[model samples]
Target: MRKDKITSDELARLCGVSQGTIDRALNNRPGISPKTKQKVLQMAKDHGFIKNQYASSLSRGTSNLIGVVMLNLKNEFFSQLLTSIESTARSFGYTTAIMLSDNLEQVERQCVETLVGMNAAGILLCSVIPDPAYGKQLLQYSTSLVSLGNHICGEIPHIGIDDCAAMFDSTRYVLRHSYDHIYYVSPVLSRSSKENIDAQTQRFKGFEKAMALQPSVHYTVLRDPDTYQSILKSIPANGGRSAVICSSDSYTIQCLQLFKNSDVGIMGFDNPTMLRRLYPQLSTISYPIDAIGQLAVKTVLSPVKEQKSHYLAHTLISGTTIK
Candidate 1:
């Protein structure tokens, strides 16, 4: 049974309650009785009504829809963002529609358009679209939009850490030690291809800037996706204290699998929760997920969008992986 087959009034009628009671029960409002709430939920389930936010939006009202667009939810960091964003949005009396771009331009654009068509009150985007023109076009759209992470969308104000500074500091951490060689791992960026996220570029800029101060230090940029694994493997692990700094924890997790307890030290950004179990000793930067996600919802739902990008502080965790 589809959700549309059962309206709020129909469910309320079957449950022997007013539509108001059903609304409170559906939204989990405190005014509803526990027994009534359970009854309503069971009825909803038995009838095959969807329990997703999209289904919730019907009862809450379409005007309260908050659309969230993300690059992908394959990693712990972004998944954390989803949980935080949805929780925060719900607290603000809004229902969210989460969509994925899979790092594709066409898909991301389609997602934005779909939300716009749905009359979303606002959109929170962590985009993979490579063009700034689309962002400028978004500026003219009727709905409010706030970039969640990347800063590439036409001077869009994004909620992100000082990526350059974060990487710069991470690089310096390895540099502070006697490490003779450093290799920075990042997804390759192709402007013509639009295959990568610019947020990765900002991190690289930071690493590059920090590396510039120490010309004597041997540093290599492994930004090519296809070649980084082979190139990283070919390098002699036994050489003078070498460190490989990964741009993301997802990539670092792979490196952790590849290197295990080798002499080559590994460092990753945003120590993902799963990584903690897999490699407790891996050093990483811990960015504030709660702060970033809450702020993203606030900025996107505001009457006026934020003009300047916001930066939050990040924590560096030192683990035994570097030693």
Candidate 2:
């Protein structure tokens, strides 16, 4: 009799009807007989089947589907992340349609529209999606969306690490090792009121705040791709200026490649298998990719049974790359 645990499926079974039929009847769509509709209503009330007004409206038209938009899927980190999300969505009996783009704004926008047109129950978004106006469009959808990444914003619920604090902790850890000239390499920041886009700004603020505490330490930022080699070539190998904190595993891997056996201490943001395998001693921040994926699925399917969204937490993993 608890309102929390009652489900649409259970209500449909109690009413001696298929889930689709119950859905149609409950959503007040045409097709089912008046008697069947009445039966479904009485049963739903008896079992305390709370209808998600949004899903009910959306369900009148299409199949249950979840759209996933991801960037850099070919990367090991994203590939692992996608696998975990896909597995979780499957467990909830949802058919997930995925769109992959190499961080192109145009392609990402197209993918979002395509998925929306498909009548997906909800969408799971990650990575650099262009067009700020599109974020407002998402809120209008009846589908429940959950963003998975450090960079996501808005009233829409998201699951990811606290980038500012995570990076601050990582940087403080590096400072504790007594390494000087700690540089943070990250993508250039963008201006937006949206919560997701604000992540980069938060991270930079964390770095600035942390740096202020230790006035003597030096830091610099490098976003230039063409002259990155020249920047790497300028660092001192044997001095106290021997450490660098990168924004991501992808950036760290690039740093490692550019400075092979160059004795420059390196660290990356996300802890990936390759980060550990290639540089077992590399210190980096780590969070559970599988758990993030699982949470995203749980959020999408929650409205199906009229469950509320839940917040998840992230923990940092320590390794040897710092000192």
Winner by TM-score: 1
Give the alpha carbon lDDT tens digit for every residue of 269-302 in model 2: 7776666777876677775677778877887667
Among residues 3 or more apart in sequence or in different chains, the pairs in candidate 2 whose N, CA or C atoms overlap within 3 Å are 152-195, 152-196, 153-195, 153-196, 154-195, 282-321, 283-321
Best of the candidates, lDDT: 1
Model 1 residue 279 CA deviation in Å:
2.8
lDDT of 1 by residue, 1-323 (tens): 35555666678789999977877887777898799899999998877655455555454445678999888888889998889999999998888899998878888889999998787888888876666577788887778887876775645678879888998898888788778888888755544266546677888888989888888999887867778889878666446778889988878887887787477788889875666787777788877877899988888888775577788899888987787
Residue runs of model 1 more than 4 Å from their true location after superposition: 1-62, 153-155, 190-193
List all candidate RMSDs to the true structure: 4.9, 9.5
Model 1 reaches what TM-score against the true structure?
Answer: 0.79
Residue 92 C-alpha lDDT in model 1 = 87
In candidate 1, list every pair of residues with a backbone clash: none
